[model samples]
Target: MRPLNKGAKRQRVRRDPAPSRLFYRWQRIWLTPLYRRLISLGLPMAALVAGGHVLWSDPDVQAQVTASLVRARESVERRPEFQVQLIRLQDVPDDLATQIRQAANINLPISSFHLDLDEVKARIEEIDAVREVSLFLRAGGVLEVVIDQRIPVVIWRGAKQLEMLDAEGIRVGYLDHRTDRPDLPLLAGQGVGPHIGQALEILDAAHPVADRIRGLVRVGERRWDIVLDRGQRVMLPEDDAVRSVEHAMAMQMTQDVLSRDISVMDMRDARRSILRLSEAALEERRVQQAIAKDVDNNL
Candidate 1:
């Protein structure tokens, strides 16, 4: 073309577009549906994680945050609306009410949040006579405590002290002496605390002869021995001991056997009954036998 003189400029051919810059690629990706969704969801979570790491890295900051939270909580809890103004006790003796007061150790107009109901109940239950407790906050900001005390049924004398026990064999209180509570029956011996129910049953069965009763003694932690007046004893079998006492009472009514000079009436076998004569009765029997022998020889 006109011999296209050497070094003559030719028409430039258009080149295909080069790949976009990394920034443009990333920008395009950011506008995609998936990238937008990730940014929306992951950005807050990542920021929260980073902030938590920063917070936990400093102990002083963590403590300050905790203290601020606690102060806020306590400020709301100590409001007048949550204050306990009065305390009332139901079915409790003056002594126990005083004990409850002392155990609670709460000041008047104290906040309910400061009073741990469970802790108060446990403290009141520390009294040996307390069987059950019901606690609640009533109208007028009154904290009410209802007590169910254990009733003493028998006096247990052991472990070097005298103690009153309930029907369930729980120790109620320590006593100065047996006569302090004459109304309840007396029980004494080793390992008798757990068997007070059976002992009471035997006593109930022996009511007809109650006047002669000295007390009930536990033998070998298994059986019972009913001591009576005039140095007499009724030995009962370990099992079904109440039946033996009933039988003895019946015999006393009919034969007046307990009034006689007997040392022990053994009913341990249940199938048969044995009697041990006192020294005086045995001596008289010997004398009578000698007299009978001499008379027979003379005949």
Candidate 2:
């Protein structure tokens, strides 16, 4: 080996300015918009997932979290604004109001959040007299229940008992006796429930003989016979029963035919009216005819 002079300086080697292959590839990937977004969003989401998994792995921590949620919910639900302290019924009678309260079965000072309005409405509508009902939580902690009660227009005397029915033929309530609802028109016999509208119309047309009307009987499930006082019946046809009744009323008003000793006024034939006399009236009529015949022969 040759020895170098002490004054001579060693030359420095030059390095490349570009990055390595691995580092260059990583830089290109980092510059990509999708990659950058993934890194930005995925890290926090992974961290959150890991943290949640660890937190919920413990039973005590899970219970605490559930309790905290329940308390939060209860805090909002127990607010005074959400509490129901009273129940007010609208458009309901006192007797029915008592029954509706019993049906509601609600505890006072309860949270409105726990009350099921639909369920309460269903309960109240179970009553026979309730036609329709609506329920809502009003201001000032009042639970208002509005009710539409059925109005009874007629009394149906069934084979078993008497039932008060509305105009639609739906039962309002049951009555112990006919005298309980004397204001409403009485109806009897089979298949009258479905034809109550016609019966009502017939009764309306018989207003001239309203005082003598006892009831109406459904004959053969097709026709109606208006039963009047003194065993008198106005037999009406199946169709145009209102007109038939009107004709009978006109006869009663003009000729006082219904006031005679007639047992039945057969208005079944719209063309003509037939009067079936009572037994006594028939006997008297036969005696008069016999006397007339004997007088003619003598002449």
Candidate 3:
């Protein structure tokens, strides 16, 4: 029943946090040494501004820039592909350049052959040509390459595949892409060539057939099936395939037996030749032998 107070007492006002003042104090502390040092040195702010420009504005950079450009130009000229300049590489001594100019000392009608872009690329890859390469104008006034001949790995028939391999069994290429250079032996079925140098050696040493074979395929794991230009398969055995191949090759030349349409001449048999006749040829020969036997009995 006593008089009730209706008005509320005033609330204390909240103060804002003085984070900026504290940060300023820290900033002053941190900067004190640097500012004092500058003041003691009597160094002017304008001097620092001038020194920065002097250190950064280097004229030597221009020389470095020019030298880099010169190296780039020289490198481009060095490549045989770009005809910008004939460099030290162009006049290679005792190389293909020398061989092509002198290789024909053994041959009569030929003195030198000119080299073209395509020929230049191919001849340089050869081992014996000294990788010698030279440029010459071809019949059509096109670029041609001349080089000393390489020792052929073997004679190749171009009708079958794309690459020509060397005697040691190094692959060149097929598709006649580079024709300015001379051709090498044709080889095929190089699927097993993943074994590298050894596989090629096997092909190189593979008897007389190695020389006469037109195409070769790696068969199974350890054998080879060689095809002659006459369209016959000469099956070389696993062991001493080289010598077995020699006997078969001798038979081909001596008996002239490869002239027949044959499917396979298996030299895999150690002692005898296993002949696989073409189906059509086999059928015809069977019929003729039967007729000859019947005629003989009647007589």
Specify the poorest-scoring 10-residue window by lDDT in model 2: 3-12
Give all TM-scores, in the order shown.
0.75, 0.76, 0.42
Q: Which residue segments of model 1 deviate by more than 4 Å?
A: 1-64, 105-109, 284-299
Error of 2 at 155 (Å): 1.1
Per-residue lDDT tens digits of candidate 3, residues 1-299?
Answer: 85465475647688976669879887675579986567555366657778866754776866676788987866765444433222123433455445443432222222223223454455455544343456553343233444434343433334465454544444433444424333433344434434324444555654445555565666665777777765778888877776776676678778866767788889888888888899889999999999999999989
lDDT of 3 at 161: 52
Tell me the lDDT of candidate 2: 0.92
Report the C-alpha lDDT of model 1 over 23-88, residue by residue, as the tens digit: 789878889999877888888889999999998889999999999999999999988889999999
Question: Considering TM-score, where higher is better, how would the candidates rank from best to worst?
Answer: 2, 1, 3
lDDT of each: 0.89, 0.92, 0.57
**Candidate 1 backbone collisions, by pair:** none
lDDT of 3: 0.57
TM-score of 2: 0.76
* Of candidates 2 and 1, the better by lDDT: 2
Winning candidate number (lDDT): 2
